[model samples]
Target: MLKTLLVQNYALIDTLEIDFHQGLNIITGETGAGKSIILGALGLILGNRAEATVLKEKSKPCVVEGTFNLAGYSLQDFFVDNDIEYADLTTIRRHINPAGKSRAFVNELPVTLSILKDLVSQIIDIHSQHQNLLLADGKFQLSVLDSFTDNLQQLASYRDSYQKYRSLTSELENIKEKASQAKADLDYLQFQLKQLNEAKLKSGEEIELESLQQQLSHAEEIKSNLQSAFTLLNADESSILIWLKEAVSSLSKISHFFNPAEELQARIESCRVELKDIAHEVEMQNERVLLDPAELEAVTQRLDMILSLQQKHRVSSVDELIEIREKLDVQVNEITNYDQVVSQKEAELEKITKLALKQAQEISDTRKAGSKKFEDSIKALLTQLGMPYADFKVNFEPLGELRPQGIDRVTFLFSANKQMPLNDLSKIASGGELSRLMLSLKSLMVKTKGLPTIILDEIDTGVSGEVADKVGNIISSMAKSMQVINITHLPQIACKGSHHFLVYKDQEKETTETRIRLLTSQERITEIAKMLSGEKISEAAITNAKHLLGSELN
Candidate 1:
């Protein structure tokens, strides 16, 4: 519950502090006494947009600090989740600086306004007089019903499963798409493989065949040239070797007479032996040479075949063709296996989808059952709140597709009179009916959600006397389990408050300021008297106010 609110230079409030208490705390004041200003400042702390005009002294900043006491409420988890420190009492502070900067803190730890709002929302609900759009929301109606029936755990589990299932299904689809594309590529690869394999090719065979073909094509000419060169060197008549042998014989006989002639004869014999050896080697090489036209043609044909295969495959070497064929074979094999894998995955996805649908249907069915009981509970409360002829129902429709909230759409149906048929609650419900319905639903939510504070802004907008007393009584009952702050003008509701604060304006140094003071029992009686009689506080109004206070105390 909200413990203390301190405002400085916020609108008409200049340095005002008000402490709150548990149970129904009512704020009563004159129409323009700045009662709503306090709520507005509180709203700023709740993440509402801050108006820059609230700055103080026309130059200084505005500050609004609120301290909330968590006590035994379940706000500890909220603090833990938000990384906020919390003692037995938690303080939430908000400040608006002169430079149009707004700052907030939770338990003195600086935080954004969104974090403060979320934390505050978990503990308190501020209901203004405007009709609640949440009431018209189909999903919200279903949620309220589920919360009323204690189906939170089941609903949460179901949603978690649904999300997981959706993720897995999406993964399966992506994998299948890639696998299908791979298969198409694989088919193209298989065709290339077949074309490459049909050509019987080998590496380096082209170069070997080309050399053989050139040799065989010129074999006759080469052999004729070798024979002619051999004849000129040794086989011809009057060859140089024959003449040198005779000269060497004559020179050897006269060597004793001349030493230079003896040395020349020896060199001449050495040259004769070398020349004979050379002739024999040449003859052997010439004998080995052979030429055949048929062999040349065969070699040429083999070379042409190898080069043609190379051009057809666009490979510079036969080795590359072999490599390409191997790669294509692997691709074709993968394509053959792809269909089986996809079939397996599809079957598995279908099974998981079925399980997900079953779970969602179960949640939808549970919500419908809860909705009936929820409607009955509210209808009973509405009767006590002076809506005896009202009929309310929770209508459930089964939607086909899956949503984050599940498969059913819920709507609230209502009829305010006995003969009227039920219509959409938002279209047919009046402000009073909406207020009472909101109160009843809030009362039911307290036991489920465990919030400790609920503030109603002008809930009794069109109510008075006995009806206002009933609204007071409902809020008073809620205060037993949680603190309720009612902003009201009705004396009946004001008298029912366990704690009362009166907001009024006063002038200090010719400047108007709003002040809030906690009222004592005697002071409350006087305030209630003013509320009962408006501008005139007659003796009868005082007696009536006293009696009303007395009745409320009893």
Candidate 2:
């Protein structure tokens, strides 16, 4: 329930503070007396849009704050979810700067407008005359039936299944699309993989092939050099090895007579042996260096193939080409296995679809059963609200496909006369009838759903006399369960409230402001008299106001 509203520097409200009470709190004033301004201020705290134009002083910010008593409401989870401090008396405040910047706060903690709206919606409902159009809305009608049936848990389950079904169906479609696209590229991938496999690639093959090609290309020059070296060392008559052996023999003859001669003979022998080994290696190399065009062509072809593969794959080495081959192999394998993957996804989708269908059927059946009870209850309430011949029904139509709400489309039908056939509420119900119907629906909702607070803004606009009294009685009855605030011009409704408040303009030297005050019993009588007669209060009007107040009290 709302406890207090404070407005500062708001439109036509320089500074105002009002305390609200439980039960039907009636607010009354003449037209243009700033009654709606209070509601507007309340709307701001409820997370409605704010503008710089709403600021009374262009240099000052506008502030609207509301205090709510949340002792019995189970909203601790909401506070924890939003990371806000919760108290038994929670205050929500809104501030709009001169630059049109708006900010919201919950318990002095900064919050987003969405969070503010969500928290406020759970605690208060502001129903204006414009909201009567919701009576004809199909979603709203279905919600009414659901509320009456207490099928929120079931609806939640159905929605969960529906979401799963949708996700799996979407996954199946994507897999099928992937398979279709992959099929187009399957043959090309296979050909590439087969080419790579037949190449028989190896690491470092290019470097080895290049070295072999160089050796084969210069075979004649290498053979000529090796033979020349062998001839100089061993095959010639005055070879260096022959001279070194003769020096070794000479040194060996004197080596027994002199120590230096022995060392010299050893050095000369080592040189002769090394030269003989060099000549042998040269001779072998000369024999093996014969020019062979077949071997040259084979090495050249291998090098050319390595270069061609590197260029074809846009890589710098055989290693990169090998990596591309591995990737292509995986792609081919996946294509081969796509059919099984798609079949598995399709099976999963079919299972979820069946489950969703069953849950939707259960939900539809519950709605069908609740709809009859809802229609009967609303018709009875409408009759009590001065629509004695009113007829109400819930019309269900089959949907072409499943939806989140289910497979049924609901419409509310109404007829205000006995002989009239039921038609859509929008086409048949007048403004007054719509108002009464909205009240009837709200009254029924109170019995089913535990509403926190409801504020009716001039719902009694087109109603008066005994019907107005009945409207007052209905609102008064609703207040028994929760807080109900009715802003009205009818004395009958005004007298029905447990507490009365009057909104009027207070003009000072240079500024005019709107103010509200709780009316005492005598003050209430005087206000009701003014509403009964308007502008001029007569003795009979006062008597009638007292009698009406007395009757409502009884």
Candidate 3:
């Protein structure tokens, strides 16, 4: 319920504050008396856009603030989720600076326009004449039915399943695409892998093979050098080994006569032994050196093959070629098993589709179950509002494929007269019919849980006399359950309100400003009388006003 509205420096109003209460609060004024301006200020509170042109005071900012009593709205979770301070009595304020910059605040904390709209929508519903056209909107019709049936939880479930089904279907498509691409590359990958496997590659084999190729390329020259060294060390009679032995013998003979000679003998013997080992190693190396051209050619061929493979794979070494081989192997394996993987994903998608269907069926069932009740309620309300012969219905059609709204497509059918055949509500309903139908729907909706305060701007547009009185009675009845604020020019409707306000213009020295005041009982009667008879309140109009106000005349 709206507690109060403070509008400052906006439009024709320099400053204004209006206190609102629950039940059917009414505001009445002549045309162009700034009732729309007041509603425009309230629009700012509902997160509507504003411009610098709306600022009445060029040097000051325009401010529109609303304080709402959120006692029964169960909106603590919304505040918590938005990280806003929660209070039973919450204030929403909008400020448009002189430069046309707009800002919104919830409980004095800054918020985005979207957040402000969402929160205010939960607590207030502003229905102007334009909203009557929503009767033709398919989505809005479905939402109205769903809200009537309280299918929010079921719809939530259906949407969750629908999303999962879509996700799984996408995943399956991706898998199939990958499988197709991999199959196209299968033959080439297999050939490459086979070639690598037959090569019998090793980690360091390339380096070893290159070294061996060098040695084999120069084997003849190397073997000749080793033979020469062996012959010089041991093959001839005057070889180094024999000379070293002679020196050792000479030193051994003099070692007993001089201690230095003994040390010299030992050192010469050590050299002789080392030289003998070198000669033996030289002989062995000469024997081991291969001079076979065939073996050299094989080593060269092996190194050439390694270099060719490296160039083919665009890698620098044997290790990199091995890596590519492993990757190709994995891809080939996946290609071989793609059918199985795709089957699994298809199965998952099928399961999710079934779940989605089940959830959609639940929503459809709930809607269908409540359809009769809804139709009866609308017809009854229409009858009460002076259309006793009106017919209303819910038309259901099954959708071929799932949508965010589920598997059912709902249309509201209506006929305003007995001779009229039921047709789409938008096609046959007149503007007056649409207004009454919308009010009827609103009256029904007010009985549902968690509905907010509804503000109707001139809902009595096409109604008057007894019908206007009945419309007021309907509004009054709705207010018994929830808060309703109606702006009207009809004295019948205005007199039906538990509280009344009068909107008029005030002329100061330099400017005309819009003003509104809560009407006292006598003032209310006077205002109602003026509504009955223009600016002149005649005695008969006053009597009628008093008569309309009835027992609760205070």
TM-scores for every candidate against the unseen true structure? 0.67, 0.83, 0.80
Predicted model with the maximum TM-score: 2
TM-score attained by model 2:
0.83
Determine which window of 10 residues in candidate 3 has minimal summed lDDT: 443-452
Candidate 1, residues 1-554: lDDT per residue as tens digits? 88888888888877998888988899989889998888888887787787678765658788888788877876677778878877767777788877778888877899987788888877788877763667888777777787787777877877777787787778778877877788767766777777777766666766777777877888888789888777866886677677788889999889998999989998999999998888788788888778788888888886776667678778777788778778777778767877777787777777767776887788877777677778788988889899899999887777787777778787889998898999999999877777788788877987688887888888787777788889888889988988889889999999899889999998765888888999988888889999988778888888888898884532
Please state the error at residue 12 of candidate 3 in Å: 6.6
User: Candidate order by TM-score, highest to lowest?
Assistant: 2, 3, 1
Tell me the whole-model lDDT of each prediction, alpha carbons only: 0.81, 0.89, 0.89
- Candidate 1 backbone collisions, by pair: none
C-alpha RMSD (angstroms) for model 2: 4.5
TM-score of 3: 0.80
Error of 2 at 24 (Å): 1.2
Tens-digit lDDT string for candidate 2 (1-554): 99898999988998999889999999999899999889988999888899999999999999999899998889999999999999999999999999999999999999999999899878998887788888878888888778788877888998998999889888888888988999899998999899889988887778888888999999999998888888889997698898888898898888888889999888888888998999999999889886999999988988888788889888999888889999999999988899999999888888888888888888889889888888888888887788899999989898967798888898889999999999999998898898998888878776676778999999876788999999999999999989998999999899999999999998864888898999999899999999998879998898899999994432
Q: Which residue runs does candidate 2 get wrong by more than 4 Å?
A: 44-62, 80-85, 95-104, 110-115, 202-216, 219-299, 302-320, 506-512, 551-554
Which of 2 and 3 is the better model by TM-score? 2
